[model samples]
Target chain A: MSGPKPNELIEKIDYNPPQKGWMDVPVKIRKGMYCYASNPKSVEYVHLPHARPWNPLEEDWKLPDNWKEIVHNAFRERLDRFRSFKVFMDICVRCGACADKCHFFIGTGDPKNMPVLRAELLRSVYRNDFTTAGKILGKVAGARELTLDVLKEWWYYFFQCTECRRCSVFCPYGIDTAEITIMAREIFNLLGLNIDWIATPVANCYRTGNHLGIQPHAFKEMIEFFVDDIEEKTGVKVEPSFNKKGADILFVTPSGDVFADPGTYTAMGYLMLFHYLKEQGLNVTWSTYASEGGNFGFFTSHEMMKRLNSKMYAEAKRLGVKWILGGECGHMWRVINQYMDTMNGPADFLEEPISPITGTKFTNAKSTKMVHLSEFTADLIYHNKLKLDKSRNDNLIVTYHDSCNPARGMGLFDEPRYVINSVCNHFHDMPRNTIREQTFCCGSGSGLNAGEDTELRLCGGLPRANAVKHVHEKFGVNMLATICAIDRAALPPLMDYWVPGVGVTGLTEMVANALIMPGEAERTTNLRGEPLPGMEE
Target chain B: MRLDELLTQKKTAIIDKWFDVVADTYPADTAGFIKRQKDPFANPVGGTTQKSLTVLMDELLGEMNHDKIDSFLDPIIRIRAVQDFTPSRAISFVFSLKKIIRNQLNKSDFNDHRILAELFEFDLKIDLIGLTAFDIYMKCREKIYQIKANEEKNRTFSAFERAGLIKELPGSGPELA
Candidate 1:
């Protein structure tokens, strides 16, 4: 028999460096850590520079000969476009408050996943190129040259971030690393360095009005299909209106919800809720053209985001709708809350979103004239408009996973909890440290939610899953209820692998289960046909 | 005293030594979480590490009678699997327990024949636990890779299905429009 094979008992990982003046350390691009490159056609469609097929693992990335100049010019333009970029770049005092705040760092234990160090990966390059102190002292002042290796390092680390903004919540100066990541990704895209995850969605949404690239006719067909599923489940033959002119409200949700499993169930919930509302004489319509609410362009660049976001308002004006109702999504709200009005707003043609049923005026959305689905549903429950049976969800021991964007970016926490609690009796909160403003990412946010980046997603996802696993073991929590569409699609596999037996559901799905729609058949099972407690004979 | 009685009496000490050996693998701050927090929600990684290590050591020192070694080892090994440890490094803590037990027994009863035979039997049990840990560690890593592949396939599921690459078959639940 072979004697004990020789290896270090303690792992050898000396690559992380000192406080400053340490720029020569080579970044290790281990397999299963980074995302695969974007498709050439996707990059080209978005008009990104140097759009060609490239692999992250290959020796040659095929970057342009003048790539450094192009990246510098792009950075300089962003420094002009956004003042926050300059503030985040220049104003970090390197306080360690945000270090332990990142779920990525908590999960991977790589110092680079720490928001401070992740930003420093790009900040070092910024100092080398633009800052006087960095130019004078070189690596001594925590600066490094923009070599090809440095570009790769920036790409690797930036994509590792979900741009969840968890660290910015704790920053003393309120330095947003999401701002830095968005800018870095834009620069990477200039040289056609894009992950297929983000690039494909941006291109698809630009071309087909949604990320799934469902053509106009096909988009209608998808909803019609969901309508049939609704009839089968709820025994309500409710026809949904699509792209009809003069509709009062324009509803748009993330395209992923329309196309993916579990997310499809959330989409079904929206249909059932809207069907009941329609039967009550409220007039709303979905637009085939502005069919998506999520902005993958938010991951690519702000300008790209504006291009995708303009469609929603344009569709509202085209359909002659009064206001917009955004469905369950995370980053969509971050854009709507912070960027939409300033970017493409006044939305002068649309009236403020007054709930046709509850008569609640959404004053917070007065400027953008858009209301979140949770806020709408919560108001419905508050005004005692909908008939909800709490026992429908008695089989589920539920907990809410606060999606990162809505949590940190908008502080839209209580509205979702309000909605979930109104519908389900079994609501539980994860540990206080891991929820609300300090919420963890679903690991695959922004464009990093793509399949090829599964390992990175799973690694980054561990902290969130570990938290869920905790509640799973402690509270006998069988279902993880969330409000975001991405969380619905992404959290199931996360639960399956990291914390088995804990299922995932959207708040709206739980709402649909509990909603006692008038003239509807007696409920035998919740959404997805899972048997209700007494029905499980 | 009989070797079985002597072994039974020292079981707590043996288990405590094993607990220290594995828990010491993490940083002090991380180790403190296990030492301090009993609530799993407050500290899951630490909680699993503490609970699983306790059960693991008990199994090794006792009759080693149960096939439920996996129930104890899997939780601990799963965490170690995702950590930045080499396969050898992650499983080495298992082997370290053998050294500690040998040193303890050697000091107490070096000359007794009956105790030496019992010590040999106990050392064999420790070897089996180490092997069990290695198996669990490999399974965890494999699960991670399998999950990544499935997610990648699932994320792009509808796109391919739309292109007629993935066809609809009955009993597959709803169709992708």
Candidate 2:
């Protein structure tokens, strides 16, 4: 190809003639430089400070002078929705407690992942604009003003924070620095400035109605893949109800669970459970049209959150499911628990999810008859139902890892543990602080699991890894279990980086492993619904 | 006695104790001084920025060479300017009320009440109270009033106990306020 296009550093020279005695150099280099595409040079640069000289007398430095107001207005119009300069300054306390909470901090000891330091990049600008001290004194009391340069820096670091509230749990004032980070990103997004990774998912959610960018057909294919997996693993052919007419349950899971690690196995468990329920003549008609329950829009803005969640509710209504089931995902539960009620509606068809078999009722239901998969499964098991083969999961000595969203955000602390304990005999609790409301983020929960925030994910996931490692060392926790699909997709990489041998699996993986084969079935098969190759007893 | 009743009694004792300490520092009529201390924004500091006297004083005096002016006269003018600052006087009035409340209520007894007091320090010390400031003052005032309401409830409950009006401690009579 064009021999790796020429590396030329193009420097803009500001020509300002001195009045007779000033320095004889006519050319003062400006701040920005664009290298010519044809020129071959080793040094490549953009917005290099030394590349250009600034002259106050030059019209280029003046606003509405260099770029037309139309272009400036366009950019400003986008930034209008960004967090107010005042609001940003008001939120951050810079306590440095968030420093240790970052996976990046724990992984590489990079001080930058410390949420406090990360936020200072934006907080400084707020101080400069709105605070008197910042106007006079710079960087002393931790304040700076937002310039165009600072805005760009905000985009860089704000995106670095994964909006995981792991740090916020410990904050004495409950100051969520992630809020500031999201605001910063939203501001950058408003200015039509977007990183490819965050923007792509946002765009996908906007278009296909899911973050995976998987169309309805592809999403259905994924559900069927899980069906095939369940059939192969157990011996039941489950047609995952898709946009089915008047289905009783619309089973929604984070798409990551269906496609990626620990979650795929969890998807298998879900299918197997439904198959068993169907065999018992339970009216559990589940569909996958509203397959993706993850609100990736949470990573962007409240408006985006509303749009995504509204789609989920509309689909649930369309499918006519009495209850909507959310799979293991962090921020999805946060949206489901905290914001969905106010944002979406008083969804009438969905009651406080009554047990279809036991006739037991859930008391604390709001927004919708929203039931977590773990709760649904565990409760069934609790009530002497969901015939489980406990011995089949003897291969694992499992310890449950409470994903923060379900634990802290939704108070779903018991259901997953109950399910694991019922199926697996080797269930052990992590340290008190490390489970339930105080559970650590898998370091990479939220969209930080992607390529862009790898460094940040590594740093932020450290505390979670440390907790897991402690459990592994003490209890020989060979298998770490969690209910969230995001944890399944995210924690494996974190485990690889921090604690190598100890692996993470979905609680349902443990369940699917232990499901008893039917004796009188037409085809007593594995998950694929075929005759067993090796017949025992 | 119920734990809450005991806890309330303990709170009254603690408030009395704190008042004793403050009484040693100044007079009980220090209500005037406390009132003076209650200005919410007496500090004239806003935002997360660091404060500098030179820029602020320069703005007040309308003189750039405020530094060249006699330093002694500046402090006097600034102090007087702050004293005359309408907000600071209002802050003092509110602060006197807070000190009164603090003197009466036990800090350890009510964690929420103590937290409210500490938060109200911004109002009491600086005199920056505005409409929002007034709302806070009224809220604290209501809390102070509730102490009496709670005392009356307790007295009635205690009398009921003595009179055998009710047997159990979470008494079945009209629940305490």
Candidate 3:
């Protein structure tokens, strides 16, 4: 029963890995660090290839006999298809500027999680197959053959990236590492190596028009349930229209806000806001067919992204809405801003988004004709359209977490803050480095927020939670507000782990808490039924 | 001088060495990065380790308030708990403080009998801290499992409600079934 000697203990705990070249180091797939393999049914549902049962932990991945040929052909096809992919694959000088910028690398301390190394995992393969020197000189030329182990390494590391593009911000060449991850994921999908978290949602979204697969009646019922709750809470009954034609705006949000906790509260917030606007003669309709704003297809493949994203413009045309208003979600906006117009546009059928409340033209969204909810709300607040009593949110010392897609992908920094500052009395920003374009990931973006990978999520969330912890200690900040539904679903558990006592909410939820409707009840509790600041007695 | 007085004089050095020992538990490349980068937000693992070790050392020498000691040990142990370390290796940093203290004491002439007694008492405190760290580490691991279980339950709960199996909505009392 005796323990080892002190020196023996120290010797046994040697975590300093031996000095080996990066190529020689083997990939170690640890439990709790990786996700379970995609369900084959989900893969086959989407008609993706190689839809056989395979586990990442096992040695035999059951890859096709010509898996190498499949990858090589797909890599070449993508190289021809995307000029950005070609440039990104050819460009990285490995100056190590993006090495420490990745939250996974900073939190987990895994060299492979470093954006440079994560891209190198794929870049080395690209060089091996495409470049002459890599083919001739081999390992000496910083390239290696694409063996089964190398493919396994690619699968393990590429999924580790959230595709937040924080590394691209620091790279001198502005090389987007996320595009490399997207390409790797595209290749992964071809081999049916998609994680269940992404593949199942993609399949569900393809079939049911939402990731949760909520049928039309069930989707309506969920909103009606929220409507009932809103009526009880505010004594103001709000009517929500579904699939109605000729509405001015078609509202779409991630189904997570309808099905998930805290996100359900955000959905209620949207209901209240829309109800108040309806009284003011603003007409908006929710669509059961294009019910989801968040796109899991973006995490699956480019073609799948387009396939799922096509629903928005198709529904907008069917409903004949002037423009679309997106709900709070992360990668959904990335797809809309970067790829939606190119892949699914010209969206010429829809009119440009002009705020009826303020008559301000959203010329920024002239191409895609979709306006973000923050921009829409901020414009409404600027024109004093809605009466807001900020004291309702006096219980909260709020800080905004810039969801990576809207912040980095869309440069949506000020609009959400402008809305929060208008809605809440006490607002503080986390360390200047951790907000806006430089904001940290909630560690669950790009469909990495599966339950089994809780350790990975918590570790990736460390830097973000650390920043929140600093502000919590300094300003007693209690609520972490965000505009993304994934952030709404993810940040609660992240805060529960890293910095307890802090809560998560969406900006719209805060606005709904502060919105002073015409004939509403005297509010005692906020949206979550927690007592307000002075109502705790 | 007495052992406590001598330890007080070398407190800063001890804490610095202790932080290095914890950092060494990571891979060499990560260890170097954590040691070199001093920014708390940029390098949270390094910052949390250094900050906790400083407070932990003071608590170990001073009144050893249980709450203060637990608070300081919580952050470091919580991090290491999730990291790729064996359970023994996760709490091993606690025992390394003994080696660091011994190395510091060996350099100074502390052969007096009273100093030896104080050293024995201090070692007991180190053992207590190690046990506390084990508890904290287990707590973090349990919390992670609980979070995972709750996540699965939350998803299922929504699905059940959507399927009309659960009659009661959330915020109402428990389901009758």
Candidate 4:
């Protein structure tokens, strides 16, 4: 009573918040949460609309005149073209089943990050412009006009989503919120508002046939460097041919594998695996034209995704390979599995992918005519083709992280695990809910894995990292095995931050570590130059 | 009973209140979800907060082991460090415990001179925990910046190496080189 009342003391704490509807609150675009704006050159390179420089942090976004009409027409056209789009916009009941499912929502504790509310951000605009109830009732119908503030809110939350489809899994209506995010991103690109992480990669992929813009020679030189690295580790040289005509199979992987560490080790894994198959007369060629397997264009727009993905079949046809074998990548397989045949295919020129060593036909990829590396390797293991020494990986207690696209887009749970189990001695699943279809994203998927937005990536990664921390503490899981190149690139820093002492690896890297190639010297080290289990001095 | 014995007797209620205060730092909707969800993996932010507060309460009553306190504080502070919290607000939960203890002991039995002296000593201990939390919070913030800096450097270094601009990646800093 003398110093201060209890109520005043409680008031000193910053717990009370303003009582306002979410729509009434203005968006506060935080730094370190969003990526920089796309460069004009990159946007222009891809011939996307409204290719002017703009920054998200600035007040003026430099939108074109008639920007509202542009958005209206685009929204109407998409609703008409994609029936699923219209259906999704109409069907959601806001039951909140998917509210807590989003990793971003769970990690950031931002209300708008909830799948129901994030969709409602766009749905509110849709209700205003597209629905009769919205037109009549306005605020009562939960409808609001699409102002510049609304557009900024759209850009912030849509990009925040990794399109991991975890929310869609929990939705009672089975509405794919990733598609909603995709539609929002496509509309954003109409105004040239693409993030630098996405626009630069799309531009590079369109021009140089890879996200890094590495020319053909440089691409080959990078692979040759990995060959040198593989030779140094295993004392066996792998001769991976590029652009060679009449090869039996053409191999394509993400360029991140060539340019980044950890992924570089995975690239070496592919080299050793292919080199081992070379002795058995398995002729596979690497194509510089389709060098990238992960499509940043998929994150940009549908037409751009098709334009970049067309190169895969085109290069495979030109090389005259019987079929194509994709490398360890996530969205790349999602594209091939779900959209490739319909988008660029009738790949009638390519044959149904059959494992040259196992003599097993890949009926799953018969239509798309492209086989996933995990599926092909799993087939090889089932056929008892490659001799493996599991003890080489004894240093690692491995847990598989199912990449979002491969887990949800395609039901590819068993193949990667089968491959991991066949090669590595110690394997543990993170948890029942966090693995397979319910697997959490590495949080950097969909071209959001830029350095500037590391905090966002780390925050979004906490749920996945938290699950990994549990297994890490319980089972001493040291290596996070994934079939995703982005995971190789992203999860290393994630593990470094949240759970130190754990390493990120690709399934192929594990396979190569355990692979006992014919005429190879006694292996002293794994692909990362870490000494093998018992050989570590 | 003694101050430690009384605190130990009231441990569950103290921790429950402490957890509520910490959870209230999140938004109302989020705080509700955090309190509602019991599973750690499904609601890590809530689970971590509850778990950290329980351990911190036990340590506050008992040995006040700095290492055990830091370890529990790590997850909660690490979370708040990335969330949109100011540094003081991020570690304010530790201080909030002082108010909770005072309110819980506000009855006449606890108002004796001896108990009031003991309460002063206990408040000092909470202040020590607050200092430790500040250190943990700063370390987590530093780690975020470090991760960001390292990622940027590695990206550029790899690109440079690929272009043959540099023969070798540099060490952690110029001083290391």
lDDT of each prediction vs. the true structure? 0.80, 0.54, 0.89, 0.88
> After superposition, which runs of candidate 3 have C-alpha atoms over 4 Å from their true positions?
A1-15, B107-114, B169-177
Task: Give interface RMSD, per candidate.
Answer: 5.0, 28.8, 1.2, 1.2
* Residue pairs clashing, model 1: A21-A139, A451-B152
Encode model 4's per-residue lDDT on A55-140: one tens digit a residue: 89899999998899999999999999999999999999889999998999998888899999999999999999999999999999
How high is the lDDT of residue A438 in model 3?
91
Q: Which of 3 and 4 is ahead in TM-score?
A: 4
Clashes of each: 2, 55, 0, 0
Ranking by TM-score: 4, 3, 1, 2
Task: Quote fnat for model 2.
Answer: 0.00
Q: Which candidate is the best by lDDT?
A: 3
Per-residue CA lDDT of model 3 for A1-537, tens digit only, reads 798986796567654557766788899998888888999999999999889888898999998899999999999999999999999989889998999889999989888888998898888888889999899988777888899999999998888899999999999999999999999999999998999999888888889889878888999988998888888788889899999999999999999998887888899999999999986778999999898888988988888999999998899999999999999988999999999888999799888889988899999999999999999999999999989999989888988899999999999999999999999889999998888889999998999989988889998999999999999999999999998988888899899999899999988899999999889988888888888778898
> Tens digits of per-residue lDDT for model 1 on A390-466?
98888889988999888887888899899888887887788887899878888888877665555567667777887
Which should have the higher lDDT, number 1 or number 2? Answer: 1
Best by DockQ: 3
**Residue B52 in model 1: shift from native, Å?**
2.9
Question: In candidate 1, what are the lDDT values of residues B1-177, reduced to their tens digit?
Answer: 765566557777866776666656654434443456565544455566667766776666566755778877887787667766678767877777656666666565868887888778877887898888888888888787777666665556655655556456411533221
**CA RMSD (A), model 4:** 2.0
